[model samples]
Target: MTELSLRTRESFDAVMRKYADMVYRLAYARTGSTFDADDILQEVFLRYIRADKTYNDEEHRKAWLIRITVNCTRSFAASAYNRHRDLSEPDENAGAEDPALKAAETKSDVMKALLELPEKYRTAIYLFYYEDMSVAQIAKSLGTTETNVKTRLSRGRDMLKEKLKGVEFDV
Candidate 1:
């Protein structure tokens, strides 16, 4: 049993290393802030460690992670603290030297336009373009139909195109 537990721990660590970037990017895309994304990333992994459920395969695990990430970001967005907080107020903890935020700020115009979109649209676009999730897969992850996902992609594309007409980035 000890050996089995040790293997489980190793597996968890491996999953963290493998999925950390993907999870972080998803969280960042959803929250539009480095600090919020990092918080969501940590919470998602913590829940992963504590959850009683198990994943049958890599796809299952990835889907599970994405679902949890979306939930975390949504909860954060809906929280009373966030709802009452001032949007223009700077994060007291995110000092000028935060490289993660600096990197987020340096994203291209296409990325900037994507961030300007509504949360659902940003998520659909991110999952489709950056994460390479299919429309059906995104629909499953988002608890919506494939048709809804396609609609979101179409609307998001229109918004992006309008915002990025002169920008030279592939859609």
Candidate 2:
């Protein structure tokens, strides 16, 4: 109704449109389950909206979202419900040809190998390569040292190379 509210609404919509895919992809990369990723995406935005925090720039806002995503995924993975789930149950759609997943998995072999890496390395690699973020940016987002991020990236690349030895995928 008011000008201030209208401006806030427009900004919120813009932020959601700009970063929704990035948040979802990061969540999916972390959880390996679309359902969980969806939930994490919702949680991250909810926090963002509720925090009502101001950012210094677009990069700061992006980094904040990344940090929230990482925290939300960690919370989900550590939840009692997740811990007690039946891990033996087979993924129903594991062999299904899902078009959405097909589109997302541009280089299937590379994605598969990337998912196999440790979470620390996987997060680093995803932010660096997939999100086109610098090591310094990732360090700030993850609240870690740049040296640590570099180490993770180096180790992640090596792990992917080993896993996709016969494949034509590059890390």
Q: How far is candidate 1 from the true structure (C-alpha RMSD, Å)?
A: 4.0
Best by TM-score: 1
Candidate 1, poorest ten consecutive residues by summed lDDT: 1-10
Query: What TM-score does prediction 2 earn?
Result: 0.81
Q: Per-residue lDDT of 54-127 in model 1, one digit per residue for the tens?
A: 66666878898899999999899889888777868776665746555565459667667887899899999999
Residue 158 local lDDT, model 2:
81
Predictions in order: lDDT: 0.82, 0.81
Q: Roughly what TM-score does model 1 have, to 2 decimal places?
A: 0.85
Give the C-alpha lDDT of model 1.
0.82
lDDT of 2 by residue, 7-113 (tens): 22347766876789999999988877677787998899889888877776677788899999999999998898776666676655567664445645674877777
Off-target runs (Cα >4 Å) in candidate 2 are 1-10, 85-107, 166-171
